[model samples]
Each structure stands twice: as C-alpha cells, then as structure tokens.
Target: MMQENMAGAHLIWMLILALVVVIPFWRICQKAGYPGILGLLSIVPIANIALIYFLAFARWPAHKSVQQDPSS
Candidate 1:
C-alpha cells in the first residue's frame, strides 16, 4: 500500500535527520572528553536543551588535562 511505503520512507528520513544532528554533537562530546553517548540525548525534546546547558557549563576533561600539563 502507498501508506505503508510512506511510513517506511518517513522512518528513513527521520533516521537520516537524527544522524545529521547527532554525529557532529557526538564528535564534539568525544573531543571534549565526554562520553559520545551523550549525543544521543539530542533527539529528546527537553533533554536536548538540558544537554546544551550541560555541555556549556560542564568542565571538559580535555581542558583539565591541558591545564595540568607542565609544558603549558
């Protein structure tokens, strides 16, 4: 049925959209020394906003390591 095909197409489109949004955030989390799994939160409505604040205010492990280095 056309409706069945549309549903499948919708699911695929949403998955692609999620990946487009998540992959960059996932990479950012990794680079910031946070768990990349945190990027999965991007798909959640309220949690996504909270995640942004969490990322912005949270102390990054990468920065801590750099600050602790004697060469710096």
Candidate 2:
C-alpha cells in the first residue's frame, strides 16, 4: 500500500513538471509565429533539439508580412 501511494505521488509530480515545462514552451512557439502544437515536440528528446534549431533559423510568418510604405 505504501509503495503504491509513493508511486502515485511520483506520477503526479512528474505530470506537474511536464506541464510547467510544456506550457511556456507552447506560448513561446506561438509568440514566434509557429503553431502552438509544435511545442509538444519538445517532449521528444531528439525532436526537441531539431525544433530549437528550426525556430532559431527559420523566418517567422508574422514578420514576413510587414510592408513599409515609402509615401508615408
């Protein structure tokens, strides 16, 4: 019984930690003009590294559409 309770507590703590890490990563992806769903890739070991490299080098969609008028 005690072992089961300890395992349950460990699982809960792990879930909380995952959420703490994933939520901000999701927001960061959104702010960078990527889909928030992409943040879930961070949960994967190798894919998370790829995602970081892609984010760093890729052009942001939000910034790609800005127009400057010379007449203004």
Q: What tens-digit string does per-residue lDDT give for candidate 2 at 1-47?
A: 99999999999998898888788889989988789988888888999
Query: Which stretch of 10 consecutive residues in model 1 shows the poorest summed lDDT?
Result: 23-32
Error of 1 at 2 (Å): 0.7
Alpha carbon lDDT at 10, candidate 2: 100
> Residues 1-72, candidate 1, lDDT per residue (tens digit)?
999999999999999999999998899899999999999999999999998998899999999999999986
| Reference-based TM-score, model 2 | 0.82
**Global CA lDDT computed for model 1:** 0.95
Model 1 residue 55 CA deviation (Å) reads 0.8
Provide the overall lDDT of each model, using Cα atoms, as 2-decimal numbers.
0.95, 0.85
TM-score for candidate 1 = 0.95
Q: Tell me the lDDT of candidate 2.
A: 0.85
Range of the 10 consecutive residues with the lowest summed lDDT in candidate 2: 63-72
Clashing pairs in 2: none
